[model samples]
Target: MYIRSAAAVSPQASFEALFTGAAGYQGEQLSCIEPDYTSYIDPKLIRRMSRIIKMGTAAAVESLKAAGLEQPEAIITGTAYGCLADTDAFLSRLVEFKEELLSPTAFIQSTHNTVAGQIALLLKCHRHNNTFVHKGFSFESALLEARTMMGENEITTALVGGVDEIIPASHALLRRFGLYRANGDSLRLVNEPAKGTMAGEGAAFFVVDTQQSANSLARLDALQTWYKPSTPNRVADGINALLAEQGIEWKDIDLIVAGRNGDTGDDALYDLFKKDIPETSFKQYCGEYPTATAFGLWLASHILHEQRVPGVEGLKPRRILLYNHYQQTHHAAYLLSAC
Candidate 1:
């Protein structure tokens, strides 16, 4: 499939800003630099939507506009933690009110599929709408389903996205479990390895079609995912198998965008696999999240489309490989070509 267009609501202001020099943070979490919603969403409705919903909707709208599409044939979303703020509010109200005469707004939008459903409602689309909530593999599962539907001739175009948010309650609970570093630096996350990585959250969406178009950003050649393997060598074997199937070797790949989240234990695999390859870490720009691979894919697509690497001047690549693993469990690789 070809990526017609891509958009993201992330911590960085823009793609150029992210590549040139991202803004540094001193806190343990990175929040998205949201865009103005007046253009994408109704002024009156914006107040009702949560942060995650607004982010996801705006991104999806921007992506569709870039693709010159008004309505997609399918809508799919992947989220690890969906509408966390709303969920927290609903649960708190349930306890405070003794489960009597509680407002249903928060409860209504607290489901894992709320973002996707909201998008569909906004567009008046009744096509195949689905959301996957498989922790780290959520985004991959959504993409895989889109690819399958396209292959089966069920849809010509689709809007697929991965979204997650960071709330105070979720952050505090996760910090208690030693997930984030206190007052960690986000800019130098990958270079200066440490015990924990900073928290991150964002929403990224893509418009994909089976046939290439004038606005095609890149050709998605291959995608593969692996679960917890018995040994590290199995990962290497899987990489080889994927490359062999694509009829390309490691030397043929011009660039590699890896997931190195500054955590020593988490970044070890990325370090071992990226040896001698023209590689760069993306987590430094976006911090660490469950579906971070979505941001990595977004970066890769833009790099191929622009024919330029952000910081690496005078070096252009034709093919890019994206490799990321969520907590060393859900591993995924994507091969993209500048076609």
Candidate 2:
């Protein structure tokens, strides 16, 4: 499959800003620097939309516009925590109001599918809409499904995305659980000798098709995900299997973009798999989120399209490998080639 166009809204403002060093990592929890919603959505509709909804819809719209498509034939999204702000609000209301006279808006928008459904409603698209919420593998699952649907001729073109939001309550909870680093330089997260990493939230969308286009950014050569590999050798075997299936070797991979979130345990797994290959990390820029690999995918696609590699030491890349794992169980790899 080919990515016709891509767009993302994150704490770094925009992907271009992120690559150009205009955006800097802030702290432990990075929130998206949202775009002007009025430009992409009507003022009236924007009032009722939650942050996640607005982020998802704006990204989808921008991607479609860049691809010159009025609407996609299919819409797919992956979200680890969907509409969390609204979910929190609804729960708070349920408790405060004792389940009486509760407003339905928050409840209606709290579901995992709400983002996907809202995008479809905005585009008036009625075909092949879905959302995945499988924890860290959520985005990978969505991409895998979209690729399969395209290969099966279920749809010629699709809009795919991953979105998540961080609320104060949830952030506090995660901090208590030692999932977020309390203090550290987010840019040097990989070097931090700490037990936790920063948290972040963002939305990224891509317009993809089975056929290549004049505006194609990159080609999706292959994607594979594994669960609980059990050992570093098992992870290595998975990587080798994917390379074999794609008819490429480690030498063919010009760069390896890894998901190192500064967590000692999780980064150790990547350390075992990377093994002397030219490598870099994206979590330092995007922070740690379940579907943050979507941001890694966006970064990989941009590097291939622009033919430039930033923040990494070594040769310029032509073929890039994106590897991400969450909780040391869900591991995913995607191969992208310059188009």
**Best by TM-score, which number?**
1
lDDT of 1 by residue, 235-268 (tens): 8789889999999998999998988899999888
Model 2, C-alpha of 116: deviation from truth (Å): 0.8
C-alpha lDDT of all candidate models, in order: 0.89, 0.87
- Model 2: how far is 98 from its true place, Å? 0.5
Best by lDDT: 1
lDDT of 1: 0.89
Clashing pairs in 2: none
TM-score of 2: 0.96
In candidate 2, which residue ranges exceed 4 Å CA deviation? 313-315
- lDDT of model 2, residue 152: 88
- TM of each candidate vs. truth: 0.98, 0.96
